[model samples]
Target: MSDQPVNLVSVNTAPERAKKVIGTVIENVKDKYTIVHAGNSATIDGVKPLLLSIQPPPGILFCASMWTPEEQAEIQQIARETIPGIRTHAIPTGLQVQVGPDGVIKYLMERIDDIMKV
Candidate 1:
Protein backbone atom coordinates (compact mmCIF):
# COMPACT_ATOMS: atom_id res chain seq x y z
CA MET A 1 0.00 0.00 0.00
CA SER A 2 1.11 3.48 -0.70
CA ASP A 3 1.81 5.90 2.11
CA GLN A 4 0.08 8.64 0.20
CA PRO A 5 -2.31 10.75 2.19
CA VAL A 6 -6.04 10.99 1.75
CA ASN A 7 -7.17 14.58 1.69
CA LEU A 8 -10.39 15.53 3.43
CA VAL A 9 -11.80 18.96 2.66
CA SER A 10 -14.73 20.65 4.35
CA VAL A 11 -16.11 24.08 5.14
CA ASN A 12 -13.98 26.36 7.28
CA THR A 13 -16.86 27.00 9.70
CA ALA A 14 -16.21 23.91 11.81
CA PRO A 15 -12.54 23.73 12.58
CA GLU A 16 -12.69 21.80 15.84
CA ARG A 17 -15.06 19.20 14.48
CA ALA A 18 -12.90 18.73 11.42
CA LYS A 19 -9.86 18.30 13.58
CA LYS A 20 -11.58 15.65 15.64
CA VAL A 21 -12.65 13.75 12.57
CA ILE A 22 -9.17 13.97 11.07
CA GLY A 23 -7.68 12.67 14.28
CA THR A 24 -10.15 9.81 14.48
CA VAL A 25 -9.45 8.71 10.95
CA ILE A 26 -5.71 8.82 11.50
CA GLU A 27 -5.95 6.85 14.69
CA ASN A 28 -8.35 4.34 13.25
CA VAL A 29 -5.98 3.65 10.40
CA LYS A 30 -3.17 3.33 12.94
CA ASP A 31 -1.18 5.75 10.84
CA LYS A 32 -0.84 3.22 8.06
CA TYR A 33 -2.20 5.86 5.76
CA THR A 34 -1.70 9.57 6.03
CA ILE A 35 -5.02 11.34 6.52
CA VAL A 36 -4.64 15.00 5.76
CA HIS A 37 -7.15 17.48 7.11
CA ALA A 38 -6.86 19.64 4.00
CA GLY A 39 -8.68 22.33 5.98
CA ASN A 40 -11.75 24.31 4.83
CA SER A 41 -12.09 25.81 1.41
CA ALA A 42 -15.36 26.09 -0.48
CA THR A 43 -14.41 28.04 -3.56
CA ILE A 44 -12.48 27.49 -6.74
CA ASP A 45 -9.80 29.90 -5.58
CA GLY A 46 -9.91 28.63 -2.01
CA VAL A 47 -8.48 25.34 -3.25
CA LYS A 48 -5.21 27.08 -3.94
CA PRO A 49 -4.22 27.00 -0.31
CA LEU A 50 -4.64 23.25 -0.11
CA LEU A 51 -2.77 22.63 -3.33
CA LEU A 52 0.08 24.86 -2.24
CA SER A 53 0.32 23.54 1.28
CA ILE A 54 0.13 19.82 0.63
CA GLN A 55 1.66 17.68 -2.04
CA PRO A 56 -1.09 15.14 -1.59
CA PRO A 57 -0.59 11.80 -3.24
CA PRO A 58 -2.98 10.31 -5.74
CA GLY A 59 -5.78 9.35 -3.36
CA ILE A 60 -9.34 10.08 -2.46
CA LEU A 61 -10.68 13.47 -1.44
CA PHE A 62 -13.46 13.33 1.09
CA CYS A 63 -15.27 16.59 0.55
CA ALA A 64 -17.91 17.53 3.07
CA SER A 65 -19.54 20.87 2.53
CA MET A 66 -22.72 22.90 3.01
CA TRP A 67 -22.34 25.04 -0.06
CA THR A 68 -24.99 25.51 -2.68
CA PRO A 69 -25.12 23.25 -5.70
CA GLU A 70 -23.50 25.89 -7.83
CA GLU A 71 -20.67 26.33 -5.40
CA GLN A 72 -20.17 22.59 -5.15
CA ALA A 73 -19.93 22.23 -8.89
CA GLU A 74 -17.46 25.06 -9.12
CA ILE A 75 -15.32 23.58 -6.41
CA GLN A 76 -15.44 20.17 -8.00
CA GLN A 77 -14.41 21.59 -11.33
CA ILE A 78 -11.60 23.55 -9.80
CA ALA A 79 -10.36 20.51 -7.92
CA ARG A 80 -10.40 18.38 -11.03
CA GLU A 81 -8.55 20.99 -13.01
CA THR A 82 -6.05 21.81 -10.31
CA ILE A 83 -5.33 18.34 -8.98
CA PRO A 84 -5.77 16.55 -12.27
CA GLY A 85 -5.97 12.85 -11.40
CA ILE A 86 -7.42 12.15 -8.02
CA ARG A 87 -10.67 10.62 -6.88
CA THR A 88 -13.16 12.74 -4.97
CA HIS A 89 -16.03 11.66 -2.76
CA ALA A 90 -18.35 14.49 -1.90
CA ILE A 91 -20.27 14.11 1.33
CA PRO A 92 -23.15 16.51 1.48
CA THR A 93 -23.62 18.60 4.63
CA GLY A 94 -26.62 16.56 5.75
CA LEU A 95 -24.65 13.32 5.88
CA GLN A 96 -21.48 14.63 7.50
CA VAL A 97 -20.94 13.49 11.08
CA GLN A 98 -18.30 15.78 12.51
CA VAL A 99 -18.94 14.43 15.94
CA GLY A 100 -20.84 11.56 17.61
CA PRO A 101 -21.72 8.69 15.29
CA ASP A 102 -18.62 7.36 13.57
CA GLY A 103 -20.42 6.35 10.45
CA VAL A 104 -18.83 8.94 8.20
CA ILE A 105 -15.39 8.41 9.62
CA LYS A 106 -15.72 4.68 9.24
CA TYR A 107 -16.86 5.01 5.68
CA LEU A 108 -14.00 7.31 4.77
CA MET A 109 -11.45 5.12 6.45
CA GLU A 110 -12.73 2.08 4.65
CA ARG A 111 -12.65 3.82 1.30
CA ILE A 112 -9.14 5.09 1.87
CA ASP A 113 -7.95 1.72 3.06
CA ASP A 114 -9.39 0.03 0.03
CA ILE A 115 -7.77 2.53 -2.26
CA MET A 116 -4.44 2.18 -0.54
CA LYS A 117 -4.53 -1.57 -0.92
CA VAL A 118 -4.97 -1.29 -4.64
Candidate 2:
Protein backbone atom coordinates (compact mmCIF):
# COMPACT_ATOMS: atom_id res chain seq x y z
CA MET A 1 0.00 0.00 0.00
CA SER A 2 1.12 3.52 -0.64
CA ASP A 3 2.24 5.49 2.41
CA GLN A 4 1.20 8.94 1.33
CA PRO A 5 0.37 11.14 4.29
CA VAL A 6 -3.25 11.19 5.30
CA ASN A 7 -4.80 14.66 5.35
CA LEU A 8 -7.20 15.47 8.18
CA VAL A 9 -9.79 18.20 8.28
CA SER A 10 -11.65 18.75 11.53
CA VAL A 11 -14.54 21.15 11.66
CA ASN A 12 -14.95 22.13 15.29
CA THR A 13 -17.75 24.66 15.08
CA ALA A 14 -18.04 26.05 11.62
CA PRO A 15 -20.30 28.90 10.67
CA GLU A 16 -22.30 28.83 7.43
CA ARG A 17 -19.57 30.30 5.29
CA ALA A 18 -16.92 28.16 6.88
CA LYS A 19 -19.07 25.11 6.26
CA LYS A 20 -19.18 25.87 2.56
CA VAL A 21 -15.45 26.26 2.40
CA ILE A 22 -14.92 23.01 4.26
CA GLY A 23 -17.37 21.26 2.00
CA THR A 24 -15.50 22.43 -1.03
CA VAL A 25 -12.25 21.10 0.33
CA ILE A 26 -13.83 17.79 1.21
CA GLU A 27 -15.43 17.39 -2.18
CA ASN A 28 -12.13 18.06 -3.84
CA VAL A 29 -10.04 15.80 -1.64
CA LYS A 30 -12.38 13.22 -0.17
CA ASP A 31 -10.72 10.36 -1.97
CA LYS A 32 -7.51 11.10 -0.11
CA TYR A 33 -8.64 12.83 3.07
CA THR A 34 -10.03 11.97 6.46
CA ILE A 35 -12.75 14.29 7.66
CA VAL A 36 -13.69 14.76 11.30
CA HIS A 37 -16.74 16.58 12.59
CA ALA A 38 -15.89 18.00 16.00
CA GLY A 39 -19.03 20.08 16.44
CA ASN A 40 -18.79 22.61 19.33
CA SER A 41 -16.91 20.50 21.79
CA ALA A 42 -13.19 21.17 22.19
CA THR A 43 -12.22 19.01 25.16
CA ILE A 44 -10.03 15.92 24.85
CA ASP A 45 -12.95 13.78 25.92
CA GLY A 46 -14.95 15.06 22.99
CA VAL A 47 -12.25 14.80 20.34
CA LYS A 48 -10.44 11.63 21.31
CA PRO A 49 -13.26 9.32 20.36
CA LEU A 50 -13.55 10.76 16.90
CA LEU A 51 -9.85 10.39 16.35
CA LEU A 52 -9.87 6.83 17.55
CA SER A 53 -12.76 5.94 15.31
CA ILE A 54 -10.80 6.67 12.17
CA GLN A 55 -9.52 3.32 10.96
CA PRO A 56 -5.73 3.09 10.49
CA PRO A 57 -5.56 6.56 12.09
CA PRO A 58 -4.01 9.63 10.52
CA GLY A 59 -0.44 10.88 10.33
CA ILE A 60 -1.66 14.47 10.60
CA LEU A 61 -4.58 16.03 12.46
CA PHE A 62 -5.95 19.47 11.60
CA CYS A 63 -8.42 20.94 14.04
CA ALA A 64 -10.50 23.90 12.92
CA SER A 65 -12.52 25.72 15.51
CA MET A 66 -14.93 28.58 15.03
CA TRP A 67 -15.38 29.15 18.73
CA THR A 68 -14.49 32.27 20.62
CA PRO A 69 -10.81 33.03 21.06
CA GLU A 70 -10.73 31.77 24.63
CA GLU A 71 -12.41 28.49 23.77
CA GLN A 72 -10.15 28.05 20.76
CA ALA A 73 -7.05 28.31 22.92
CA GLU A 74 -8.43 25.80 25.37
CA ILE A 75 -9.19 23.32 22.60
CA GLN A 76 -5.77 23.68 21.04
CA GLN A 77 -4.07 23.19 24.39
CA ILE A 78 -6.05 20.07 25.15
CA ALA A 79 -5.32 18.52 21.76
CA ARG A 80 -1.59 19.21 21.97
CA GLU A 81 -1.35 17.80 25.48
CA THR A 82 -3.45 14.70 24.87
CA ILE A 83 -2.48 13.58 21.40
CA PRO A 84 1.14 12.63 20.90
CA GLY A 85 3.30 11.63 17.93
CA ILE A 86 1.20 12.80 15.01
CA ARG A 87 1.07 16.42 13.89
CA THR A 88 -1.73 18.66 15.10
CA HIS A 89 -2.90 22.13 14.08
CA ALA A 90 -5.45 24.30 15.83
CA ILE A 91 -6.80 26.37 12.96
CA PRO A 92 -9.18 29.27 13.31
CA THR A 93 -12.78 28.73 12.18
CA GLY A 94 -12.78 30.82 9.04
CA LEU A 95 -9.38 29.70 7.87
CA GLN A 96 -8.00 26.49 6.39
CA VAL A 97 -4.60 24.87 6.65
CA GLN A 98 -2.97 22.08 4.69
CA VAL A 99 -0.56 20.02 6.80
CA GLY A 100 2.26 18.04 5.27
CA PRO A 101 3.35 14.56 6.41
CA ASP A 102 6.36 16.03 8.20
CA GLY A 103 3.94 17.84 10.55
CA VAL A 104 4.43 21.21 8.91
CA ILE A 105 1.77 23.43 7.48
CA LYS A 106 1.89 23.54 3.70
CA TYR A 107 -0.72 26.23 3.28
CA LEU A 108 -3.03 28.50 5.26
CA MET A 109 -5.78 30.56 3.72
CA GLU A 110 -9.23 32.06 4.22
CA ARG A 111 -10.45 31.49 0.70
CA ILE A 112 -11.59 28.12 -0.60
CA ASP A 113 -9.81 28.58 -3.92
CA ASP A 114 -6.53 29.19 -2.17
CA ILE A 115 -7.01 26.12 0.00
CA MET A 116 -7.87 24.00 -3.05
CA LYS A 117 -4.69 25.13 -4.74
CA VAL A 118 -2.63 23.28 -2.16
* Deviation from truth (RMSD, Å), model 1: 3.5
Count of backbone clashes, every candidate in sequence: 0, 0
Question: Which runs of model 1 end up more than 4 angstroms from their true locations?
Answer: 4-12, 42-44, 56-60, 97-101, 114-118
Count backbone clashes in candidate 1.
Answer: 0
Over 1-118, each residue of candidate 1 has an lDDT whose tens digit, in order, gives 3455566565434667667776787778764766666665544566656655665532445456555566666666666666776566665555564444376677666675554443
Candidate 2 ranges beyond 4 A from true positions: 5-9, 14-20, 26-45, 93-118
lDDT of each: 0.59, 0.46
Q: Report the Cα lDDT for candidate 2.
A: 0.46
Writing each residue's lDDT as its tens digit, candidate 2 over 37-63 gives 233333435766656656555444445
